[model samples]
Target: MLARAINYAQNQRSYMENYLLDGRCSISNNAAERAVKSYVMVNFLFHDTVKGAKASAIVYTLAETAKANGLNIRLYLETVMTKMLDYKNEPDSILEELMPWSEAMQKSCGLNNGTI
Candidate 1:
């Protein structure tokens, strides 16, 4: 069963073959692969279940994006979790407050503060 599955996967080649059919499609997922390389390298970071792995990926994305945008990751997540409950039901107005580039979000998360 294992050998058959491996053979089938190699024959499928969908992971790389898609690049031939679509110019916009990536030739390689090197960026995404590199993004998870560190997490995967740390043995303790591996999750045994798909659900936990997905959850970890989501958290990692949030942290990385927050840090990249000059927001305090801890504060950004805390504010997002709390405000999501209040604004999630509202209209697009939440976008103004939740977006990392938005003035409101920057101010709220102290991204605009005179500190790195």
Candidate 2:
């Protein structure tokens, strides 16, 4: 089972490496590994059930991504959650707004202050 899982992951990685794909890259997923380590730390400390672990992982990933983008973590999250609650809609498409590369944030503080 473990071997099959590894092979499946390799195949998926290869598929994602297609040059024409917008975010495709022929590289190991080390960045994602490091990003998930925060959730792993929480799991190690609390040993929560799968549902709680998943929720923590999602929130950690968002916060970490915000930090990576050079945004103030607390402010970014507050702004995002406020907008999300105001919209009262699923936020799948709005994830881009949370990213540091968005012009909305750049215009607020300019490039230097905004570059994470």
Candidate 3:
């Protein structure tokens, strides 16, 4: 059992190391994974207040969404919020502008490195 476990771990490590050869691959998903898991656990603490729970969930969603797209939350939110004012009357336009994978949003968030 011990030998099998060790072998499995070694296999996984070797697999992950190969990703380093790919220029865009990230060595670390730990931070991002932990952040998401932490939110899931933390949500239980705010379950008492419906309004607060909803608000917290939205913030968590926004934070995770921004992080997923290689965005700096503060900068992304600032830029998006400001730009959103111009398109408030046009919901569809605002939706396109706020998409994490959109070209304009990628540029605004400094994620123009050929990524989504």
Candidate 4:
């Protein structure tokens, strides 16, 4: 076991060195682990069907992205769903305006926009 550990360390020496040289590198993946915990916990709820799981993953990703971008997740999703109907027959390019990171969405759904 000790020899295996040393061999693994040796193989990863360059990565370890990069971590030490990069001040911006995190020592642990706790943040990413925590981020995925929610998805894992709710996974069973969607596991019954592949389509359900895929839908859940898409919605969850959008919610997380909205949160990360400082947009009110609820408002962003609500606005997007409401506005999407208007562009249902339009080209897909029109949907870009509804993205969480888009200027219009940032202005309307941003946490600092006082709408929350």
CA-only RMSD, every prediction = 6.1, 4.3, 8.5, 5.9
Best by TM-score: 4
Best prediction by lDDT? 4
Candidate 2 per-residue lDDT, tens place, 1-116, comes to 99999999898986766644665553576887887776687665784687876777777777777766666766766677667776676667765654556887545423356433
The estimated TM-scores of all candidates read: 0.59, 0.63, 0.54, 0.66
The count of residue-pair clashes in candidate 2 stands at 1
- What do the candidate models score in CA lDDT, each in turn? 0.76, 0.67, 0.74, 0.86
Clashes of 4: 0
**Which stretches of model 3 miss by more than 4 angstroms?**
1-35, 111-116
Instruction: Please give the range of 10 consecutive residues that has the lowest summed lDDT in model 3.
Output: 107-116
Q: Per-residue lDDT for 16-114 in model 1, tens only? A: 587899786677878767877887788336688888888877888777767767898888888788888888679986556686666776776766685
Q: What stretches of model 2 exceed 4 Å from their correct place?
A: 1-14, 18-20, 23-26, 42-44, 90-95, 107-116
Clashing residue pairs in candidate 3, if any? Answer: none
Question: If candidate 2 were superposed on the true structure by all CA atoms, what would the RMSD be?
Answer: 4.3
C-alpha RMSD in Å of predicted model 1 compared with the true structure: 6.1
How should the candidates be ordered by TM-score, best one leading? 4, 2, 1, 3
lDDT of 4: 0.86
Clashing pairs for model 2 are 70-116
